[model samples]
Target chain A: MEITDIGGVLCNGIKEGKYGLGLVRVRGSIAGVFTQNKIRAAPVIVCEENIRDGVVEGVIVNSGNANAYTGEQGMRDAREMCRIAANLLGCEERRVAVASTGVIGRKLDMEWIRKKAPEVYSGLGNSVENAERFGRAIVTTDRFVKKAYSEKARIAAVAKGAGMIAPNMATMLCFAFTSAKFDSGELYDMLRRAADKTFNRLTVDGDTSTNDTVLLISTGKERVERDVFEEELCSVFYSIAKQMARDGEGATKVFEVRVDGARNDEDANLIARAVASSLLVKTAIFGCDPNWGRIIAAAGYSGADVDERITLSLSDGRDEVFLIDSGRPLGNEERARVLMEKAEELVIRLRLEKGNGKGFAIGCDLTYDYVKLNAEYTT
Target chain B: MEITDIGGVLCNGIKEGKYGLGLVRVRGSIAGVFTQNKIRAAPVIVCEENIRDGVVEGVIVNSGNANAYTGEQGMRDAREMCRIAANLLGCEERRVAVASTGVIGRKLDMEWIRKKAPEVYSGLGNSVENAERFGRAIVTTDRFVKKAYSEKARIAAVAKGAGMIAPNMATMLCFAFTSAKFDSGELYDMLRRAADKTFNRLTVDGDTSTNDTVLLISTGKERVERDVFEEELCSVFYSIAKQMARDGEGATKVFEVRVDGARNDEDANLIARAVASSLLVKTAIFGCDPNWGRIIAAAGYSGADVDERITLSLSDGRDEVFLIDSGRPLGNEERARVLMEKAEELVIRLRLEKGNGKGFAIGCDLTYDYVKLNAEYTT
Candidate 1:
């Protein structure tokens, strides 16, 4: 599969004979979000620079080794990646940002990429198969290819993320390219909002990876209005982000926990995150146990300012719901059973009695498979 | 079978007949520490007061509902519990403390406790059998009786905690009564310090409960010196605490993760916790995969300052130790076989190149039984 088939994107994978492997995925305009880690990677630095500049040409990604925690050598390699991609595309290096993911502390295999760049540049195509292939190539541990397309705007997005998800930002490495023409400023705003609403709202195992990145690019092939293009682009990106959350390693069911009527959005987010990231709560969901006590208990201690009189409703993706309020469980067993047996996905709703702050977080069930994948990873 | 059998401790379980159940277990003079939670329960307030007064003649614990989040009413209940015990023991209420664990929000069932206070007082005894009953009466969801004794100092402690355990705290309810006699102040300080090294180092599921309490009482029957008593008491508590971590719902094995050579103790603790609480890491341990990648990966992202070029060793409680470093496994087939041959307790040692930071955290292997337990909990 190749990214070029996704309407307006072009991608090339290079075996930089020495530096390992390199990939260039481009779109004339782009929208993106970076990690919130205090000690961020090189790609985040470049992405922020491009977004702040109000113009972005494309993103260059490399795998096999992460150029992180290596002092100045890391920074130099990031700049070099941008420079190489820029020279080939006839654009400013700053407009061509870079991202890398792999083992940390290792230097880039620059000699390898330096030799393979030209061959990769000559090979670009547009097809769904190609897009899927690009998606698979970008992944580290992801089991499925994550791609979403919106026919109305002729935009498509492909993401790579298998694990390292949490409440704040998913520890992911994603490259999304689209052909829709849109203003760079609008694209940046749309990306940020979409990320806050999607990628930032997921918790896989509460471990935030140090090398997480999400980059969106526009090829400007459609040349649509900025607002129209952005709407479609955000929709596509949202779909991809949700898919990433759903396809989290060992995840069996996707959960959307909505917390409302809190003292503030931060409080709501904390409460939601508490429930989403709780191993007990997640395991219960996986077991199909309607353990409302665990859910309420998590919310109660989430450090959020909530009143005891707050109302809570939990559902297993259906009309059936369980209520807990005033520190007691309410409703009959049949209703609870119906809710528990209803759906594979669960939705938990909480209405705090403190204020009107609201928030939503997405999560997945914790299963033995999750343990299997993570526990023996190196073995 | 009882906490009293461990050594020397007097206990009474009071049911008021309507709202709550009350208990009073006393040590002659044993050490105690306080909770870190700023918003503490009323019982915690009483415990602190008694500790400060340099006398811990009695502890009054209640279940059926936590006397928390109730403002003044909660305080009254706590004080009343102490007063009732104090009057019975011929001591000041200031010397009698209180603890509560159960449903949050509802006021203490004062009426029920008041009605059954006489019966509870009548049942108080100095025998080990009474102590065991005290342990059982204080429990909520624990599957087995948790009691520990160290013959070196004739010190014994019993605890009831099956869930809601983390680094910070949990719905953990523990009461340790000993025959060794020490001043109240000394007992309090030693107990506090021992707890910091023991119970505080264990985590069941990483969820901190709002109403967690641990109390130590001395019956003054055995006159052990402060040093010897502290050593034995701490050793006993650590054993029980380790048991608590091992007996966590669905937990298969207890893991003692020792992380040394970090920037500080806090840093070590953070890294150890990150590795111990990781579902993937725990699961890998269950499968005996010796997956060093997951361990190192979790450490890399544990929000701690760590140097990747550090030493790693795994000990399976026998004559086998495996070494891994720089992202590679270095153990031989015999060691690997030993790690996989047994289902006994395991210890993981991680050495970082940061400063001097030492941390220890206890965890359990993730297994299918955990899934089954949690899945069937609410159903």
Candidate 2:
């Protein structure tokens, strides 16, 4: 297994504003997932086509503009990006996936991109700095860098997204590389399963973006067992997903939610994601108010099979206590206050007593800073 | 036709710690609409039973507790409220519809409530002060008193809500009265039609509350044609609903939205409400972004049939210009700025060119004040 130094070029482009871009090359089969929003960005469309052949050699990410909603010209620009990357990497354009993230609706500056492609290619080398650069280049409004490495040091991932997107689908960007033996189909099935329980369950805001995407590459340089690789992938995705929730635009703490004892996984997820998406619950956590009624109310409206015979509890990653038991308030203000006052993480646990199914989702508390950060710009 | 002074009593209850409550008695056939949430509040449950007889002589509101999710005791407390109001108003308990709004799940302070019922009854009179009291008493976190009197001087209405509740349903409490000659059937039909285009279109924080109700009463003293009364009711509800949006918790302005040229009324409403309920669009309006892309994106995801052939415009209730023409940015910053800068109200005009059916919805911008007001407490 080898690392590449090309990530620095991608990082440099974003920092310099010459072009918001990044690139990483791997000799492997690749699989990907894209946003479900009907309105698709040009690069997302480009990536969709390039991944069809299953053999992917590299990934190129551009920032500064989303290259979305630009009509036909936008499509041409995205294709040109792949063409440029292919030329530099000495691979077919179809084997290279390209992604763009930034403000939506603006046209990409291809002239600047054309000039930087060769530089990013020359910068490629086997190193951790290259991976870090790749992570830095993909960021949009993210407050912190999110990347993870597997225990055996064969798998690595970088992700960037701070704004709230959606449940059931992603509205951010992610890329993972592994020196594990797998075909595109095998990798895609595993990636989708892992994502459904990871990034897909994380919501920042309710708005779904047009540029969400995730790519997984199997470099085949090392032979890790499938089960172990899956475990590592899930772990890495969890860490990055948690980071995204923690660094949610203007967020102060990560809000972790678990919905348990439901009739099925779907019901559990429905309630858990609904609780995560609720601005009232978010703000309650933000203000240090352990108001479990809001949580129950949100669950009631989640289209899940919820009744009065449910219990709700809150914790600060340590001490936990039920605020509502069997649909009645169990007042414990002192313990709740101490738990809610945590500055890093807040946890909500729900038990429905309806079934054994359970699900989890993460969100950030809504704060004045969140509104300020998101509302100040026109994007 | 006459105006009563009982409003002051209602308003006073809200102002003092005595109650966030109101009661208005009229000799009429009454019709009502309530929230569709499965987790019905105790007061909502009681109102549902009373509104059935089609002979609502009075409306008794008890504030300070929502009387929701409080189990059997909450049910008893709500019925008891009607029992007390029936005794004081010289009517059967079934003749009075009851409503409650405040923090959810706590038991009603019946001792305090029993002490205030008689004072409220004694304070009732035939003056505008009484009507003011009724309006004031219904408020929870409302920053303004909302009331409307029809131009014909035969109809008056009062409403209170500052958050989003339901789409096909309501999330606020409103009471309206008329001396027009109509049966409960006619008035209910009129009220439902008017509300569908007015209150149903208004959105705040997109969180559906468990307790939401609207009641209309007819005194049968004056004769107005059904069409005319419907028109009048629509106008009154529009005015009050606009005020609710304008004063939404900490909202700064009423964000008005109009969806036109749709395939059907449902499609138009779906698109319009989607635009109104979007946090991204709300935050943009609050930030004075004039970012039309967010509006288009929201419409696309509204579960309505939409394509590239649509036009979007912004206005400040007067001057207006296109932000997107047939899915392309119109690039008119100057006009958009003036329209978005209006302090009182801003408008979004959509032309889908799909058909003639149109729809309207009202919402408030995402602002720091909303977070501050809602986050400070656990309600």
Best by lDDT: 2
Model 2, span A143-204: residue lDDT tens: 76677768563677778887653231224788887767789998999898887778878842
The 10 consecutive residues of candidate 1 chain B with the worst lDDT sum are B14-23
Docking class of 2: acceptable
Q: For model 1, state the Cα shift of residue A81 in Å.
A: 9.4
For model 1 the local lDDT of residue B80 reads: 91
Local accuracy of candidate 2 as per-residue lDDT tens digits, B4-95: 52122132233466356676667678899876555778898899898887887667887668888999999999999999888988999999
**What DockQ score does model 1 reach against the true complex?**
0.27
lDDT per model, in order?
0.67, 0.75
- Please identify model 2 stretches exceeding 4 Å from their true place: A1-14, A165-171, A204-207, B1-14, B164-171, B203-207, B261-264, B353-357
- Measured against the true structure, the TM-scores of the candidates, in listed sequence, are 0.78, 0.93
